[model samples]
Target: MELPEWHGPTDDAELDAIERKAFADSAALQLHLSNKSRIHDGVILEQEATEGAKSNQNHIALKDNGCGEFHRLRTRRLPDWSLLKRSCNEHRTKVKYPAIKFGGQIVYSRTALEAEKATNELLRLIKSNTHAHSGNEPFPMGLDIEWKPTFRRGERPRKAAVIQICVSRSHCFVMHIIHSGIPPLLRSLLEDNSFVKVGVGITNDATKMFKDHNINIGALEELSSLANLKLGGTAINWGLGSLTESLTSMELEKPYKIRCGNWEVNVLSKEQLLYAATDAYVSWYLHQILKRIPENSCGDEKPNQANAIA
Candidate 1:
């Protein structure tokens, strides 16, 4: 399960930007707070909203552009993003998605959750997958992280190491490519004038965005919506396999034995690329199909897009 070295699984030129961004992130936020500065969550910010500021109070302004809303605060009263991150230890938080579980495994409901952004969730997922596989790096996204490139040979496993993810808006085409790595299928989506991304566990997807494609794509939602058609409903499958089965009625061909096929095989076989594309496009199509149906028919049931089953 150890990763081997190569030209590294990335292009240095491409990674340069990511490295810069990571560095800037570290610098922009402060770790220590003096008596003059304080840290608290949104709730604390609400409490500290008492009238005007003191004449001599030196304060740092804080804002969290999280979950579709921008929350701004003067550092004197609000939580410091860096502090919360330190407390969380960059841990991944599990959120709800519209997926199904069967045979002790969950299938991805891609369409239902395609609206979610993937880059927002990529770093955490990549870090987790690397750890699960016992990569050289213990944590993929922490301050001290290392990466060793390796490959899984032979018949690939269906449960190749992938943490299913969806975005807040399925329409973020660029972000999807960034999170999922540069799957050839994604390149096609980017070229297509009518391509769109759909899904639910977008935050998880965002974690892997950088490592996979070496791109941050901060504005994926806006870009995808402009290029592709988006459905207002929930994600169809939480992962690619379930999305394929639900939308195309065909079980996705599993590639790797212990992990998803070596996505970075460089010379990926046609069938492998086809399988990957199937996962992306089938879900896209299924979402479109379901969009044509009346909302009332979707039923009053409160469904989920987490861990979809094939």
Candidate 2:
């Protein structure tokens, strides 16, 4: 499990300015510790690594991973993300939220040729749609990925099995990449920076794409970052289901069975197709709503931190 990276002031000048402002305002910086013992130990080790000379010891040095995150190479332990996983699972319950469905046509492509044609059609829509963008603006598309679930411990997860993209409410393309290897044309489109892929935690999807298919997806716009910037509140992390509801007052229903179903199957069931299509459509639709919101419009609100099933 990957934790979100932290960005802090870089130089002493900026730090001094922050301290001066805090003193002038009679405010003190507050640090909240969720796990005191673990954090304290990690911090102590990190300080030692920075101040002490290199030693020929078998113990791994606690080093910063550029996000103020400390990691020991040989004694590393993966963080437990079950709580986050459970929060995501709760969003998928149909009983908790109303169902959100896409009325658009879902084009399922299983072969390399079919995927190429579908991708061409999607590109054509992006090129011709003046309503969505203007000169020199990136065409935004909702993107999501799915793979077969692995329950085995210490086993690497399977590669991405399905790639879903939607440029508008009228059409969505679900490419069964497990069956049809990523074709040259599809790779080209993904690598193109002109078309921006928008979704929650989309950077993770980009990483998975590179690891699995050797394809470097470019022009990614993370929905959470966009929301934090555009919504003009105390910056908060977001989840797809929660963000959709916040913007549109519409529930983005994600059924647990369909969401966790086998995406690598030869043929996707209607429920699976609808689930995939809706996820992409909601992402696109939410971006359309969020982009129009004027900055500093009293949009500040408590954030919903439920993890999106990306």
Evaluate residue 137 in candidate 1 and report its C-alpha lDDT on the 0 to 100 scale: 20
* All candidates: CA RMSD (Å): 20.8, 15.3
Summarize candidate 2's per-residue lDDT along 1-310 as a digit string, tens digits.
0112112212334323432332222111111112101111112111123345433232455654332447664321111111111221221222232445676678888999899898888888877775758567688889999888765677898999999999875678899999998999889999999888999989999999999999999999999888666655345456787666445434676666676668899888777887788888878877875665444323232122231112
lDDT of 1 by residue, 167-240 (tens): 11121111222123344433333233332234323333444444444433231222122112221222222334
Task: Please give the CA lDDT of all the candidate structures.
Answer: 0.29, 0.63
Return the lDDT, model 1, position 224: 22
lDDT of 1: 0.29
| Predicted model with the maximum lDDT | 2
lDDT of 2: 0.63
- After TM-score superposition, the amount by which residue 69's alpha carbon in candidate 2 deviates from its true location, in angstroms, is 22
Candidate 2 weakest ten by summed lDDT: 76-85
